[model samples]
Each structure stands twice: as structure tokens, then as C-alpha cells.
Target: MKAFKTSKRVLSSLIAIMLLVMSCQSFLAADGDEKKPLNIPEITLENLQVRGGSTTYLVDNPPYSETAPTMRDFDFGPGSDNMQDAYIVYNYGNEVMIESLTLVGWWPKDQAVKNISLEYFKDGQWVTAQENIEVPWQTSGGTEEEVEITLTEPVTTMKFRVKINSAYHSWSDKICMHLMRPNGYIVTEFKPLTDAIAQAEKLVSQVLIGNKDGEFSQDAVDSLNAVTNEIKEKLDAGLVTADDIPVMIEQIETAIEEFTSSQNPMENAPAAEAENLTVSLGNTAYLTDRQISTGMTVSFTDSENPAYLTLDFSGKNLNATGLTLLASSSDKFTLNMSAEAEIDGVWTEIAAGTDFNYRCDVQGTEGHKITFDSCTASKFRIKINSSTAESFTVYEILWDGLYDTDTSAMDNLINKANSIIKNPASSDYPDLLDILKIVLSPAENQETSILANQGKIDTITQLLSEAISAFDGLAQYEKGDVNHSGSLEIEDVTLIQKHIVKLLQETDFFDEYLADVDNDGVISIKDATSIQIAISSK
Candidate 1:
């Protein structure tokens, strides 16, 4: 089957514009309060263009820099010598998770935008998030144009680019983006503020003086003096009453005392006392400082004697998902006791058909995979389905030394993660990269630039540098090859002219998938384009 040929110039122009869209606006969103500003990620500008007075957005030739700006300054036209094209690049921290993006176009009069589109990374490749929206902007009588598009899914970073469609009136083609921050809220009340200020002040004192200066000490004396001076000045200026001064200072003193006590190193930190565990539905347990070695059989059991459940850990990670029914040998299995629930006053069985009602899956059947699966709530009762009273032995896993343990598994994980991250829109990429860092950081520290157990950090460092160089090269190649063909053919120019849409959306179509060509995981669009550019140059 013949693949579609896309215009390089049009595609780059569109993608670049979208990436730049992030840098154009400086809207600071509040996650919950004005005190805590939301964090927006940076995106890359791959390409942008204006032809026949129409605009188009495209995928960037090179992968964007992780540290790229999230937005930029935009200025369209004063007419005669107007800027017909522009592009930008950016990266979001960790992951992008926003519901929608709002754009405020800065224009003098009502103007029309030809087309608008968004591109984002997903599934290890840059994929189109939404179908193209071709709403001809009839913005003729406005100072600033406002447009908002709801996204199909949450995104951490994206490229948004729009082109100016010739309008009845002349206006500047500028737009600003306002991103929603996903950090949520720190506090919903003002009480936290007073406590915060007090805590800060206390920290300052502790750092300057000794921790022993608590209660009625010199540190306290100095703190009181400072408070008295401030209160005296405010009172003299009629800013506060004497009663208000005492109340304020008292609050300040209370905060300082709390801070001093909190920061002080305790002589005897309480040791955690291990308890013979009880397994109950709704009983919460946190796994910290965990490890897995070759001969470990992980399991969980109920509080009652004679009954216990063992989990199979033969595969990689735990693969149990919501409401899992596990057993050691089919005899001592743990399952939700109640098969039904009471509605208002009457009881009813949960029904057998739907996956929601009741489900069961095996974990250790010789060739099984371990995964992080969700299970039914711990609140449910554990019914021992097996009539034989027996106690199953599940070997407890041990905690290996922190950092890289004795295995090649960490190396394999890092390699796999690197491969996945390079792909656009791969949900697991970010997490895998994160785990690699945590696991490989010791290796990273052992050598200046090499990854853990990769042997010689320089090798990995070189790979990173090479990847970046390839990305840069792709960006340059896309700019040089405006017309889509491999050799700048006449048909390529026509392709760019006639179908602006296709050119913008599919500029480096196959490269994104091909870049991670070897499927080792770490081929970002920039990596793919760079390799293509290198090949074209050769």
C-alpha cells in the first residue's frame, strides 16, 4: 500500500505554531488558591505557516526540549509586512493532565482564523488528540478574541496553533493560551495562613539560635521585642488597638513555639513496633522499603486462625486488579463473603453476569504475569471458600539494599523505559522513566554521566546527546524541505498548496513510529525526525 505524501513546509509551520501557542500566553491558573500557583508544562514548536492568507498547524520536525517554555509572545500583522508564519517547542513536567485549553486572541478588530488544531504526545508517539475543527472565525468587531476547546482527554503538554483566515476587517493575528493546573488545593481556609506565617518565623529563629532557647529564653526575648516594636508602631499610627496587639503577638508566639518544637531533633525517635498482622477488609497497609528477590512467595491472610490465602509471584510484578480472588492451591482462597447487598431494607445477590457483580482470576498458574491490579474494597469480608481447614505458608519478601540491587533487571527496565518515553503518548513511559531514575540513580551517581549498570555512564550520556543532535537535525531538515517530496519535486509544491490540512497534520508521519524503529523504546519524534534527516543528508 502506498503511504500518503505530506508537505514538509505546511506541516512544520502548523506544528511550530501550536508549540509556540504555549509561550504566547502568561495566564497563571489557581489550582485551589491564589497563594499556590498551578504548574503548566513546556511544549515544543515544530512548525507553522500561512498560505493564500490561510493558516495551518503541523507536527514539529524535532522533538521539543523538556525545558522549553510553555508559552510565547505573538504578533500577527500590521498588514503589508506582516508575519505570515511562526513555530515553537515545549515540554510538560512528568505528565500532562488538563481537560481543556483556553485561547485569548489579541486582535484589534473582528478577524477570522482559518483552522485550529492541537497535537500531543501519547502511546509513545505524537498523535492527534481531536479531529480538526474548521470553524471560520468571523471575529470582526472585537478588541480581543476568546475561544475555548474541550479536550477529548487530559493532557500534560500540547501544541495549539491557529491561522488567520482573510477577514472583512484588518486585525492582528495573536492568541494567548491559559492552561489549567492540576495540582489541586493546598488549603481551603485562612487559618492555614496564620499558622504558616508563624511556622516560617519559628524556623527562622531556630536556624539563627539554638533549639534550647525555648520557653523563657533569649530567643524568646528577642522575638517578643520584635513583636512589641511592630505593635507599638501600628498602635501609634492608629493601625490597631492594644487588645488587638496582644492577640496578634500571642498568636505569633504560639506559632513560634510550635515551630521550635517541630524542628528540634528528638533525642529518642519512636521505633516502629512490628505487630502480628490481622487481614481485614478495609484494613489499610502501606508497603515502603520493599524489595523482591528470587525465592520470595508474597501472600496476604485473614485475621482468624487456620485460614490463610497465598498469592502467586512467579511473573514480573503483581498483576492483580480490582476485586481479585486468590488462593495458594485452590483450597485456601480469599473472596468477598457477601454475594449480595441490601437495597433500602431488602437483600439482593450481586448478579453473576456483569464483570462488576463478581469476578475471579488466577495469579500463579506456571506462566503468569504480575501486575499492579486493583481489587475489591478491603471493607468486604473474606470468606474462606475451602472447607478444609489449613494454613498456607507464604514466604515473606526481603528489602534489599537501597538503590541498584544485585541484578540486571534495573538495566533492562531503564532500557525499556527509555524506548517507551521516546514514543509519543505512551502512558507507561513517564512512570517507567521515573522508576528507572529512582532505581538507577545510584548507578547514575557511581559514574558522572552513565546510567546504572549500563557500564560506563559515558555510553548512555553519548546516547542522550546523540538523540538531541538527531532531533535538532530533523528540525533543520523540515525547514529546508518546505515542499513535501524527498527531492523537492513540482508535485510536492502543489501538494502543499492544494491540501494545507494534510501537510500540516502529517509532516513527519512515519518518522515518529519509525524513530523508535528498533522498538527498544526511546525514540521520540525528535529522535525519529533526526534519524530521517541524517539519512536524507547522507
Candidate 2:
């Protein structure tokens, strides 16, 4: 009984194979042997419709000629209004693979359609297949030039639209095309195979094999390639029939699924380290010192000329990533502020606020912050203006970025060493004095060179720190000695007072670490009082 069942199954398989072969042979013998130009019948008003553009000229009897093709805007003589946007759509009633298009222009020079765009409907949407096609204009009483455009690849669709973009004459906007012929094959029977081939080609072009995002594994790539090559071989040999198409499409789809499953997720990859560059205020210049308080907080009153503040990064380029404006007002005020960046010697406005309303009593009125993509600039300016006379106090104008040549660490170490050397106590020990001078001499002379070389800065900072630590006498300087003058004196108290009041410039040399006598990690009136108390006790 088992043997009989096996023989029956084998016979059924053989019968199926024979049926498939016979069907392919019959199809090839019929019209599948070679491709021929489609025999599209004459397009009349019944088959053609105006999908887009003017519909006035699409009537059965136009104003110019009743026999002329309806896909035209007839010229009403010179100085007539031209048709602006016009599109003629043709429904072929069945799927066809379009290969080329032939356009026959009118004989008149200025009345003929000069340019056109072709679009086809596919998958429920109209897609532009070709554009900017120039149809040659025929001079009066001259031979007409028929322009034939061969498509890069055949498009399969049931409907198409022709857009008349321009006319030959500038004076008249009238566009006329005598006739249009599309050439290709009706591909209703081979639609499945063509669609599958297109999908496989798209997959092959998009798939990648690498250790990155959206990349597939090598095994997945190899599997896809094997299946694609097999399908290509069968297609080229003309052995692929209707029955083979389903299996080939299934194999390609399965390969694509496997490739997608093998893709590496972004979360599994190592994350990139972010830059931790230090932030500091740049050198600022005021347009006018009148009615302005240039202290820790900047304040300006409304004047005839708008007040402006410019921040220069000391000739160093910065990739500015963010900005902040800290301001407070007792009364309600509205002002206009424009932020400009000096790019290539020109001040270009990047951001502006037409009515920047601010009041201390209002919620969310504390500050304004703006973050942008990295912008490289060495200078930036802010201009403030208002119609009503009002006083505006800005506590801080912060710009966040990474400098091109970051010498922040080196600069900090240099300031520390300079503070130690400036102290009168270090002069007592000649050896310590000579060592400090020698370590800072190279930095003083080749400042620009050291700024460019990060390795050199690291080496010098390490050496200088080690030398200062090795000498115990140089490291034990008295606290509150802002000038490093070796002792607690009135001069130290005065310097602290000046710093607290913002009387000193940023470029002014002073030791902030030592001046913070209160050890609260801040320089305030308490630190100055502490130094005065210590001096009075002595």
C-alpha cells in the first residue's frame, strides 16, 4: 500500500512539471517571443481628460480649430493670455510598460509647446517619470521636427499625464501639441514578474555589509546574493515561467527578511565619548560707557543711539553651541534685541527678538536661552533697542562653545605659578625663585607655539607643578596674599576689594585661589573682611 502511494505522488509531480513546461512553450510561441511598440488608438476627447491645468480648451470644439487635438491651449492672436498650468491625462484602460514618448509640435513658431513634463500613475499616486523635455519649435512653412525621448527605464502604468511647462513665444502663453505617441508593451500578464524584479533590484542596491548601523551580516549578504543570482540566471535563459515567479519572489523576500533580522542595533554598539571642554567668558567691549554699569552685572539705559555689547574671543575661533541671556527688571519692559555674528568681516544677524517682554513678577520671565548647531566665529555682538525709555539690567550674557586651540588647562597652571612667583616670600629662597623663572620662561616666549601643541603644555604643566611641590618653602605661602606679597598686608585687602567690586579687568593678574581666604570656594566681602581681621590682629 505504501509503495503504491509513493508511485502515485511521483506521477502527480511529473504531471505538474509537464503542464508548466507546456504552458511556457505556448506563451513563448505566441506573443512572448519579442517586444513590439504598443498599438494605441487615436486619443480623442472621450479618452483624454484634463487632470490638471486650464480646462477651457478641452471642449469638443475649441475656439481655434474643431479638429485640432484637445490637449492644447489655442492662441487668440498676439498679446493673448497664455495658459499657465496645464496637464492632459490619458487612461490606456490596461497596464502598459512605456519605453519612449514622441511629441509632435505645431508648425507655428511662437504658438507651439516648447517644454513639457511627463508623469505616470503608479500604486495610487502620480509620479513624475520625465521632466524638462524640450519640443523643437517649427518655423512657419518649415518642416516640423518630431522629438522622440527614450526613457532611461520602462515604466509600467495604466495612466499618464502630460504637463505643458512653457510656450515658444514670450509674448503669447498659448501652447499647442499636434500629437503625442507613447511606445512600449501591454504588460498585464508579466506584471508580477516585473514587479518582483524591481523589488529585488532595490533590495540589492540598498543592502550593506559592515560593522555599522543598518548594516547586515556577511552570512545574510551571501544568502541574498545567491538567491538574486539564481533568479537572474533563470530570467536571462528565458526559463522563468508563470509558475517559477512565485517561488523566485518568495526566495528573494525570505532573503531580505533574514538580512533585516541580521542587522546590528545601534544600542549594541559602543557610544561615542563627548567633549568636556571648559567654558569661560570672552573679552567684551561696550559701545559707550555712558549710563552703563560695567560690573558683574551689565546695565544700560535707553539712549538716542542703541546700546551694543561685543564679545571677542581673543583671535581664537569657537564652535558656539548655545547662548543665554540673564536679565531682571522691576517694571514691565519690551525691547528688541538682535544677535549678530562677525563672519568673514561682515556682521550677519543670526537671531532676533522683536518684542522681548520681561518682568520680575511674571512667571517664566527669568531668562532666555537659545541653542543652535555649532557655528564657528571669533566675535559676536548684541544690539538692544526699544521705543519707550526703559532701563534693562543683564546679569550675564553667556556663550557656550569649544575653542579651536584650547589652552585652558595650561592657562590655569600658568596663573597658579605666576601667583606663587609674584609673592615676595618666594624671593627669600634663590633656588626656588630660579626654578620657577626657568619653568615659565619658555612659556612666556613661545606662548603661541605652546598653545598649538597640547603635548608640550601637558609636559610643562607637570614639570612646573612637580617643581613647586618639591620646594616646601615656595608652597607654604600665606592665605589672602592676592598679590603673592609673602604676608597678610593692606595691599592684599585692597586687591580683594577691587575684585569683589568688579573694578579689575579680566586680563588683570591676581590669584583667586589664595584670595578666597574664607575657604568657601568664592571671592566675596567675607574674604576681604577675613584678611583685614588677620592684619589688624598682627
Candidate 3:
């Protein structure tokens, strides 16, 4: 069986445009606040046109009738009766959650599709959105009949497929299918502006691989590199923002058009091959001096059970969408949590505390995810405060960020990213020979490069994406929150003394959770002594 080809010039163009738009937009999106439906462009996947089963005649038929059954432009053949499987995917430029899909076919009741499965891409793989989708065999029907398959949850992806099991031999027109992204207010803000550039730079490296391997012409490389540099110019001036993400994605659609266009078609670009990114935090990361984690060096502010943790990304800046923390308390309690980052050498508040109501049944000993101010920061600090409690325990902190944990992989990626910043998108960089090396090398061989010794790769597409996120793979109670309030004041000392003298209920919030200040997981006078120690030493 033969595979369909992708346009050669479009991909590099897509990479360049996405970055240019990202370089020109805002930093924050209020979740789902924008009221108007965004003008997200539809992505075209050149890789998905292929053969899966035998005896299935693949036919590219024109529109069966006028109004696209479900509004899809084209349809494929139902093929001969035995033709069991055929798959196709459409790339919507931006990542979108599709809740429903519509399919239209003009076939005899016998030839109509009987069963189907719908899948969407998430993380790094495809997940079944609707399995065994039953399609009532349509009697000879007009081309206007539409079949809608509803999904359980909104599946986010740029590519999705419908695999038809069996169909009566189609005599004439094929089926046209339409996929929809919920037309709701979609906030374009995702990652920090600079991170978007990094992602764009990552895509640039991929195109360079195609270029070195003769998959892309020099003209394509020159054109893309020029756009990449313009993006860098914007970043250098700190002129970019997060609101550009949608436009950045739209730019990718533009590139795809040029990529798939006959102008300079690459020989073997895979259909639906690009793996979306979900960059994670790495292992070498650590908290302040590893101090509080050890339970040895305990410090307190003027408040009781003060819950706070500080982290330094060092070379890896934290540009997270949201953060999650693990808080420890023997009993349930509420605390106001806040996050701050050091930007421009001064501390700035990013996420204001919107205290979570801690219901013992639902939240358990763990606190929930928190939304904070989003920005790239060298150092980030999280503080949790309580009005009624004095001491609590914080178990862990997690930051969601970009791919490449092994600093070396990031270093290689950074090298490529820097070239984008250093050069123009239209100029050619002869030094990008490293792109082919990064693409073709086995991931386990680090002697050559850091990314070479990591996650999944070998194929050009996987290599590009796995290269970024290949390194796969936090707490808390605000401790000393003794009175069940998040502060370390003399009032906590009074509560602890009272608890020990049989004046207080053992199950009360303060006595149960914060009184165990030493964090032995048990209540004891020693905890009171330790809280005093943390106080006097202050």
C-alpha cells in the first residue's frame, strides 16, 4: 500500500509563523474567560493518508452532494465490501477538545458504516474517545444525512481518526466528516512567552533535521530561519506575551499550508506524526538547602504554623501553567496559600490566595492544585497562611513546565534555540548540522549528546518532540501551624501547652495536626518544645 505525502515547504513555515505570533502576544489567560469564540485555524495532517488492510480499495471521491453532510470538505471511498479498515486524521492548528463529530455518507444501507471507533491525542499518545461507535446502517439515504458520535470527555488534540469496520461497496460518493472544537471562550494564554519561543525553537531544530537529510530544500530552511530570528528579536526586547499562543498556533497552520503545498513538498513527512509537548519537572531539582525537608533546620516567621517553601530552578527557569502541593495536617483545616516569584530582582505576587475549603471526606490529607501567577522565574516561593491554625506540614511541591530534564538535552535544544534567537528566520545556518545528528542518533547514546541518551526517538518526528520532554518523570502542611492556624506565634505555644494538660480535645484541628510540630506523625510534648525552639531561635 502507498502512503500520502506532506507538503515540503509548509512545516518549516508553520514553525516560523507560530513563533512569530507567540513573540507578539500577552502573558496570562484567565482560564476560560474570553467571551468570544477564538478564530483557531484548522490544521491539515499530511501524514495520515495510508493503507492499513488488504482488499480495501482506497478511493478519493468528490463531494457526494452540495452541503457537506457534517460540513467536512472531502470524503474517502467506502471501498469494496471486504475493505475492513481505513484511517484519516485532520490537524486543527491549535490543541482543541472535541466533544462531538459528524459523519455523512451516501451509501446503500448495506454499504453504510456499521461500527466505528474515535480517538484523540493527549500527552504523547492517542486515547479512544468513543470506542465501538455504532452507526445505524443507513438505508439508501441522501447526501445530507448526518451522523453524530458524542464523546464522554472533551479530548484535546490536533489529529483524530475514524476507523470504519465494514461498508457496502460504495457505488459513487465517499463520506465527508466534520470535527468540531466547542465554540466557547478559549483563553490563548498557556506557557510564558519565552517558553513558547523555546518550543518554537525546538520545532525549528526538527525542520533542520529534515533539511540535512534532504527532506527540505535550502530555500525552505532559509525562509524559516529568517522568521525564527525575528521572533528572537521580539524576545530580546521582552516584547512577547502569552496571549499570542492562539496566533502562534494559527501561524503553524500557515506553515502547514506552505509545507503541504506543491511548491516544495518534503519526500517522507509522516501524517499526524508530530507529538505535542507536555514538558515535566526533573530530578536534580531541590528545595532550599534541602533544609526544611530534613526536619532539622526549622525556621518560623512571626506567624504560627507558617506554611511556606522556596525553590530555585538554577539554570532551568520555572514557567508553569499551574502548581500542585502536598500539605500535611493530622486533621482537616483551611489555609490561604499564595505564590511569589523573583522577577527583575524583586519579589512579585503571582497567585493570590483563594483559600480552598478543606472537607475531610473529599480532600483527605492532601491539598488540591493551585492556580498562581504564571511567569518565568529563577526563584519561586509559596506561602500558606491560616487564621485559626498555627502549625501544619507541607509534604511536596510540583511545577508543570517544558520538556528536557537532562540539562544536556536541554543544552542541545538550547543551542538550536539560541541559533533561532541569534539568526534571522530567512537566513541559512550551516552550523545546524547538529540537527541531523540529534535526529538520527539513538536516544540511549549520551556520549554524543544528552537527548541522545533519553526517552523515545529514532524517527524524525518522535526525535523532535521526545527531544524536548524526554526526561519523564512535592508537600505539605504549613508546619508549626499548631493552633490549627498557619502561624508560629505565642498563641500556638498556649494552645500546645493546653493540649498537653488535658484541657483540649485530642481530635481538635490544632491538637491533632499542628501540635505534632516535630512532625513525628504523633502528638507529644516534644513537639511543643520544638515549636518553642523554632520560636526562641528566631
- Return the top candidate by lDDT: 2
Of the two candidates 2 and 3, the one with more favorable lDDT, higher being better, is 2
Overall lDDT per candidate, in order of appearance? 0.33, 0.56, 0.45
Q: How does model 1 fare in lDDT?
A: 0.33
Instruction: In candidate 2, list every pair of residues with a backbone clash.
Output: 82-173, 423-484
Distance (Å) between predicted and true CA of 363, model 3? 59
**On a 0 to 1 TM-score scale, where does candidate 1 land against the true structure?**
0.20
- What lDDT tens digits, residue by residue, belong to model 2 across residues 96-158? 677676554445455566666778877567888877766544454332334556776668766
**lDDT string, candidate 3, 144-260, tens digits:** 333445566656554566655554544542443322222222233333333444544544454423433224455654565565566555533434456655575456445534532
RMSD of each: 39.1, 22.6, 31.2
Q: In model 3, state the lDDT of residue 68.
A: 31
Candidate 2 C-alpha error for residue 87, in Å: 21
lDDT of 2: 0.56
